[model samples]
Target chain A: MVHAESSTFAEGLTKEEVYTQVLEQASALLEGERNWVCNLSNASSLLYHALLSLPRPSSGVNWCGFYVVDTINPSQLILGPFQGHVACQQIPLGKGVCGTAAKEGKTQVVEDVEKFPGHIACDSRSKSEIVVPILQAGKVVAIIDIDCAELAGFDEVDQKHLEGFARIIAEGSDF
Target chain B: MVHAESSTFAEGLTKEEVYTQVLEQASALLEGERNWVCNLSNASSLLYHALLSLPRPSSGVNWCGFYVVDTINPSQLILGPFQGHVACQQIPLGKGVCGTAAKEGKTQVVEDVEKFPGHIACDSRSKSEIVVPILQAGKVVAIIDIDCAELAGFDEVDQKHLEGFARIIAEGSDF
Candidate 1:
């Protein structure tokens, strides 16, 4: 009967501190849960609420979720668990930001999504986005995708911490 | 690029009308998507935001999500996509409201969760709940679980509409 604790951040916590707390919370939440569906579902909720608890640019987060490699179609990434409005159902590898992250097996942090060629507009309000590849054995199994309503909403700090967050997910779940 | 449409309801729309619109929207959102992960992920978002657009008791919804029959462990239900606080990762058959719905292959609408025998409280804020079993070929495959903050939050209307909602999900996806 593990219930989801409401997200509440202490005042004056820096962005790094918040992410650190979020990653710790995610680890605790996913403990003893090896099912990727269950782990990713709760992780997305935790991350989305954590971002909402932050201040300014970070608080502008509009979407936070996952896109996992489709088992039926290996070349595409199907929408996984997410906490946001509805979203794109499928993204071909090497196409959108999420796909590129999976294809290149690296992180993609776009300060302005409009400047990225072939950028997919899943939500019109999203001006910036960050996609982190969740790699296992040097191959991407999924990606952590976040969108912000303001330009330059994500930076190196996000890339670093989110990559750590992705590692936690990869290790904690049997993907 | 199919972006999630922000949920909006016309002023004075009846609950049935809202449910009708939600079902239609869900059908449209799930079109051509047979993957259960993609379907359930978006379905939960659509349902959660749709309930938020309603007034009063309906608007008090605190949790709206799903739990599918575990692929590895057939006797338990692993949490599926959802839009709410984190929830129980797994529930044994016939152990909770969701389990009862799946075990009996029927709907369970508890007016007060405290009174339900062996109720599993995944969110303390949930005062009432409704669990609708998603059946495919007379076997339960998944469930539609919704929780509200007030007692008797769900009634016949919710059961009817949510059952319709569940059917839409079952037919649209390859669970």
Candidate 2:
């Protein structure tokens, strides 16, 4: 019974609960969808809407999107599907938080972007960020990046859940 | 001086003035960028941020994006880069507003989507819409879609400006 509808996670749910639902909904939404662009597009929407449905006092997410490794220029990561304000179009492979994540093959949970050296402030409103590298065949192919407007917005729970989300995409997608 | 920054127009600026700046920024952003995906990505970002910078009480815009004619399935339009909430992925040509725009090779300015027969309610919050076709060699290649939350949200001004916007993309992009 799954359709193109954006699924809504229950309100006042814990971060882990929200992400669990997100993973399930994402799996359903991404079923039989092999187009990398199309999958990333829906994945961003899933995360953005699920997080926005959280209860009051929750740190609102300002951005959710992907930075995909450029096929033409293998050393750079170009902006992929995203939801939020305008963003930097490209990031060198080893520079910013996204770049570092890709380079080190690790998840970066930035508590405060201002303190993160070489952080590319694509939107000045983004106070905190979390990036999970999507690895395909031991190579960083893409990264799911999320930003919140409040300081210390992302925690280990978010990191853990988002990494799971990334694994699903990495394993499911052709890219 | 034209970096990847989103440009801002003045408050109370005329629609023509707003679109004039949009075209200018669009041209600046599209220069030497021939990739259709990259161009459409930045174009959507340009229009979204440009309209969002308008003054208070202005009819707020909810979604802005593109539905590109699928090369594999020539009779359908697939969702491209976009901002705002999640959106419908595919539209059979001539079925909905975006499809009709692609089928007719003209612009569709729907004052009230409720009255527009066959209007797909991808997002229920969208009250009005405008879709402009991007034509190449007299063939419909894609359509730029904008949605607003207010009834009668779009008008002749939007149709005129966005059509012009479409032309620039048609001529400027390699699609």
Candidate 3:
């Protein structure tokens, strides 16, 4: 199913079509564990893995990672699996993309990293990024962080779709 | 804002409006208490607090509770909270409105009690109900279980509003 060449972005697919596709695929994906309907952490790790398995994940994504702030120690975001340069695993909840996303419970899309308050350069090659918060009950629990080597790599499509995916997994979790 | 009068059906309030109100006021409710997030063991206690804070939360609700399958313990919904009588604390994940909502990750609006499968009659006076799951990442973390005292007590307004509130709180997280 590696179909980056056949991706809707390249093919210019309709929003309704995309919405239908996602809706149609929702249950199957949920049952398949892509949405991880039974668990939160494992499902997120699975989501990152699925993204990595996608075609051209690396070109657009300089890094793909998730971060969980230490439950016992609140000052750091322990790194989840990632594909990128050495990252600063420990950052305050108000610093950098991961931190801000966690702090605001809103997605942070940076088309220009240089303008961000405190952009952490995990990879100097990275030029833009998007960080979506994993919200639980209204507080920032974690974040699905993606960095792209290209500027303006993400758009409303990615925002709505990825957030939809996050909703599929996080909206009903126990942990 | 306790507007719903008894001896008659409450009508005209849209679920979307209730949901928007809940979302807009979420930060105000959950921002200060060091957060009320909970787990299976303390689930009831958390639900008790939520029931108190939710807008006019008592109008249609006779018993509002929280139930979680003791993941480590297995097969029983550990008791959490309620504004009324003692409840059947342990319920299977696939059984009642609570279980079904948790299992299906969809809101369950039961207008008739006799037709409800595995309907736990904690309150014989309650003839109708609505249940919404609190999801996180994509898993059923917890459920917002409400039991109403009248037949056909919950309408689409209740269902959609409850669902939206469940999603927002579960995602944005206050506890």
Candidate 4:
């Protein structure tokens, strides 16, 4: 109940399972030693762990990342934290999904990555994505993003759950 | 002595006075009623307080602000917690002093706003400028900037102190 019950190879899981898993994982990490210093990291590891707690593990997302705008390099988003393949690190702010979202302060859900413009294919198997902007006050501060190896993987349910996680991040960490 | 004695304005304040003031402020705000949150505002307020902490009252710095790369808007840096008149709310990543420093990853000093191309004029009264990008994991996250009403007002000493304040902020806040 504290995690997504299904795996990528299996069918999806129930929503309750997904929620329990996500909360349990986050609570553990937040209560752990690294929770305080974890922000110093690329920060993707924490988000990945949180996602793993979902009940529908078969949503098939294996890669996750957090992107922050580089104040020194205003034209790019510096990769903050991630748990996945080596991605296109210096993403142009207005170009890729990450960049465009960061550029406009909006959320982007791509059902198919291949069809997206300037899609940086860091992972050839990633077929779907859900990117949400972490907002502070009225502006965007960073993004919590996930990528799946399955097609049509993420849904409204995923969005709602992940958004819940994003709120926690916005409240707890300076991402 | 940790921070107060080392400050350039140390001569005007006794250690006891400094300790009493800080303790009083901390107790009044942190423990009593939580007024320090009002004290610990954005760069504009922090910088203003820092000036008050100095030996002489400061003027000329008619405006102060922070430019952070917008997490949602990747191609531009959005304005954040700051003081002064209404500022250019957005600066392109590769363009002006704020943008160029962010793009090039360095501290930028502009002796005259008129001399800097693509200089954004939120207030025509602002002349000289200084910008320092705060970085985390080799990535720029924010900029601490000050604009003066006079030319050639900022230098290495100012950079060091302002950077010191920026360090406190970079380490103190969540994001």
Q: Who wins the lDDT comparison?
A: 1
**Candidate 2 segments exceeding 4 Å error:** A1-10, A55-58, B1-10, B55-58
Q: Candidate 4's C-alpha lDDT?
A: 0.58
Worst 10 residues of 3 chain A by lDDT: A1-10
Q: Sort by lDDT, best first.
A: 1, 2, 4, 3
Given candidate 4, what's the lDDT at residue A159? 74
The residue-by-residue lDDT of candidate 4 on A1-175, one tens digit each, is 1111111112254665655565445554343222212331213443454455454443376667676666666787655544443344456788767887888877788889899998776567778888888777867777777888877667777677777766666666543
Model 2 docking grade:
acceptable
Worst ten in a row by lDDT for model 1 chain A: A1-10
DockQ of each: 0.70, 0.36, 0.01, 0.01
Model 3 DockQ (Cα-based): 0.01
lDDT of 1 at B168: 88
Q: Candidate 3: deviation at residue B169, Å?
A: 36
lDDT of 3 by residue, A1-175 (tens): 1111111122244543544454334333344222111233223323333343344422366555566655756665545433333344356787887788888788988887878998777567677888887776876666778887778766776788778766765654433
Q: Clashing residue pairs in candidate 2, if any?
A: none
Q: What are the per-residue Cα lDDT tens digits for candidate 1 across B50-161?
A: 8888887889998889999998999999999998888899999998899999999999999999999999977788999999999888789999999999999988999999
Q: Judging by DockQ against the true structure, name the best candidate.
A: 1
Evaluate all candidate structures by whole-model CA lDDT and list the values in order: 0.89, 0.80, 0.54, 0.58
* Per-candidate TM-score against the hidden true structure: 0.96, 0.89, 0.40, 0.43
Deviating ranges (above 4 Å) for candidate 4 = A1-13, A24-28, A31-37, A40-43, A46-59, B1-175
